[model samples]
Target: MTPITEVEGRRLALSNLQKVLYPATGFTKGEVLHYYATVADALLPHLRDRALSFLRYPDGPDGQVFFAKNVPPGTPEWVTTARVPRSDGPARMVVVQDLASLVWAANLVTEFHTPQWVVQEPEIADRLVLDLDPGAPATVVECCEVAVWLRERLAADGIEAYPKTSGSKGLHLLAAVRGASSERVTEYAKRLAVEAEEAMPGLVVHRMTRSLRPGKVFVDWSQNAARKTTAAPYTLRARAEPAVSAPVTWDEVARCRSADPLAFLAADIAPRLQDHGDLLAPVLDADRAGSVP
Candidate 1:
């Protein structure tokens, strides 16, 4: 058994990931491993490859473990690592001094890929995301109401929308549409955003400028293209509470307390990967008529 120290934790995490990851269908371990390795190296290079998440340091052809000596004392769970995966080579293993260093580094990984397997493919379907954010004054209760309404409307259109916690403080409603080109996807997204705004009247906004609409839920269309990604389904965001995007049936939207979007953890994610296969498969089918509305 691997010890649960930071170093061991990451290794164990990788091992635990393998258990569910290996069973994921459509894409085999080779594909997933390649993705995992690629994403870890290219996107989340700040994470070390030890007890929590795998971190690889290029030491010419060989690699090195990472450690941190500058981490301050008394850090939280998410802040344990320091060194991220470097884009350049000459990597080596080093100890991360404490938990604080690790967590701080993870925040830099907001730009990584959303793994090709987790989303519905772009060719078969376009995703129109309604990112609902309730400000500090906004309760999760209010968000649930909007979710309930959104679910019914989408179902009536013969569209399937999946709900996930935004890993922050809101809800992300992902509706799968037929795959189209980026322009097509944007157009579809715009139409959907218009419809959603009209349907809700006051609750949802269709603007992308955050500064313009400080406390409003904007219909984010940017997540629809190739190379663009959202946080993977069920990925744990760095938060104290057990905030995760707990998967919910469309009918269950009203039952949740709030849409704080932080209902998932890394542990909760693996099983989903195993059971659902990649959520993107249907999107990849690319039969235009079958995909488009």
Candidate 2:
């Protein structure tokens, strides 16, 4: 029988601690929990008050996976949850507000921690997200180039944007907004994507069509929608290698053009946090101003 691990005074029944989740790196479930716990101080701030959708892999990265919207039944009452309204109906979503909750979620093998753009309210969006996904042969290098272009454009409009590695072969740029309506943000993002595509002809694709993707980076503006969720920064991706959705500086983003796409991994996050702190911290500053108004 697996013994319960005590973290921050919380007794969690952790199982398969030695089970390798990332076969390539031989990263175990215990390591995953440790990573979350070590980074909780920086990570929980981003997740606080946000509705989280869990992508669980019970049997590690090689096994079948499922996403849990509503906190699974039998969740401890001490763990926080928020009632969020969806198209079909209102669903209760887990809100990771503390270290205990974060560790608990990690115990569930929640590899991808996706959170809504809005906070507690479903209508208000606090940030604008731009997901730059490169199709085959395009590579993250193209995504980096496109991101720099977008960042400069936003800067010209007096907006400050934060960039991060998507933990996979993509990049995510986010900017703090004044709790704007999701529809407004979505429209604004779509228009910006179109404008970017126009500015860089062969480099950017605004639409979601797959065939149009090859050799082009897809500017996924659709992530701004109210129902849409993006992988929270610092969350580990469910890949053969334990890569994390690490927040990066603009300088790092620029350098990534010539570096490996998987440069940032689970092992790299702690050292980064120690050296640079949270690069995305400004995204949570409610008073910070910058938008395409």
Candidate 3:
């Protein structure tokens, strides 16, 4: 067994994560590294004290790697490992079967992907997206500032919200809730977006249309249905240095340009998943209950 350092462990884990990720997403070989790094950084933190593992798809055929959960004797494979399917393709996915297998798993498949569009779970969600160019000439500080404001308001509503770096110059705030229809969810989302824009005036923009929202934050509410799309968690984006849809706390979102939710990696992601684990849970409930009517 290779003695592992923290850095080595992360590398191994990421390599393993790639196997299921590659062919599923059809990511080209060149896009793998950034995708892996982004997901590794965001998800690693939450993986503590758990039996965790990953698979990777490096290049060419036979590039798939797999890991069995690094657990004590007698643990079940099904209990310790899981396969997360990529929304892009039904059969395509990244497998994180266990921990020690990290090193061997990085060899399968190829390509890195960023969502031009992404599909999310079925259900309505109350979402507030702060869209902006993190790499623009403007300061990331300004972007973070807006996130702080959004976080505060959402928190006040007793919403259990999660943040994701948009893999671009923006951030997404996903709130899980119940008892809301799609229409109500969309209305609530618009209300929140409008309110945020009103609160900051020029600091944030809520216009969803590209032509209208040239250089401002647009509170996107479109990710609110069964087939609707949002950036996939940990999926590598199409950028030069790809960014994943990393989870973040309000504090981190409020403070950093890129707050890596490295703590919430796959090993821990399962535990965090609620009954209707996806963000749309609450809104779906509302709609089903006729909240919109």
Candidate 4:
């Protein structure tokens, strides 16, 4: 029988507690649950009311992986859901609003993803994320240079941006926005990508062509769309180790001499959380938002 525990009045049957999801480090499923519980306070606010998607690795990171947008069968009745219109019809996605739901989902998935808009207002965007992915020859060390440039450029336009490691292999620069639709934000993000490319030729590339990304930082601007989702801040990435999509300080980003400086593992979270409770917190305040310029 699976061990049952109650979290905020919801009963959850946790399975495979000793199952290692990350064979590289022997990180177990139980540790994954614990990590989410530890960071729930800071993570829930970002996930609240947002439609979630996940990449599940039932057989660990090196095994088969599948992307899931629709909530799988047997999801608890307590889990809030939203039916969003898609090309094939309406698909139901999980909307994790509480600690219980987050833990339940964390137990089963390797990564957590959320869109820029909330379920209550799917058409409106609350944040804009610029995904700065480094190409093979260009590492995240190089992306930091681009992020610093983008920050100053955004600051000039009165938008305050925060930096975070992608947890995969890049940097995600996020800024809060008020009353803007995803379409408008997407366009604005695209424009920034183009401008960044022009300003730093050969360093930044806005185009999505596979070959163009070889030695440049691909400034991905399309994730700002209502339908697309980004890896939620604090979410664990399914890498060789249990690395997290960690919120970072500008000081760290600017002084990053190598990729090692920016990389953060799951164990590093609690300490940072204690020192700086949710470095991404400012992006949550709607009042602190800047217009999509």
Look at candidate 3 and tell me the lDDT of residue 88: 56
Superior candidate under lDDT, 2 versus 4: 4
Per-model C-alpha lDDT, please? 0.44, 0.84, 0.43, 0.91
Candidate 4 overall lDDT versus native: 0.91
User: What is candidate 2's local distance difference test score?
Assistant: 0.84
* Candidate that scores best on lDDT: 4
lDDT of candidate 2 at residue 113, scale 0 to 100: 56
* Model 1: residue 281 alpha-carbon error in angstroms: 9.6
Residue-wise C-alpha lDDT for candidate 2, range 1-293, written one tens digit per residue: 97877767878787889999888988998999899988888898898888888888877778988888888887878888888878789888888888888988888988555544545568877788999999978888899999999998888777789998888889999988764788888898898899999999889999999989999999999988888889999998888888888898887777775548435888899998999999999988877856546
Q: What is the lDDT of residue 120 in candidate 3?
A: 37
After TM-score superposition, the amount by which residue 292's alpha carbon in candidate 4 deviates from its true location, in angstroms, is 1.0
Q: Between prediction 3 and prediction 4, which has the larger lDDT?
A: 4
lDDT of candidate 4 over 194-289, digit per residue (tens)? 999999998999999988998899999999988889999999987889999999999999899988989999899999999999999999988889
Global Cα RMSD, each model: 13.3, 1.5, 11.3, 1.0
TM-score of 2: 0.96
Per-model TM-score on C-alpha atoms = 0.50, 0.96, 0.48, 0.98
Tell me the RMSD of model 2 versus the true structure.
1.5
What TM-score does candidate 4 reach?
0.98
Model 2, residue 253: displacement in angstroms?
1.8
Please give the clash total of every predicted structure, in order: 54, 0, 59, 0
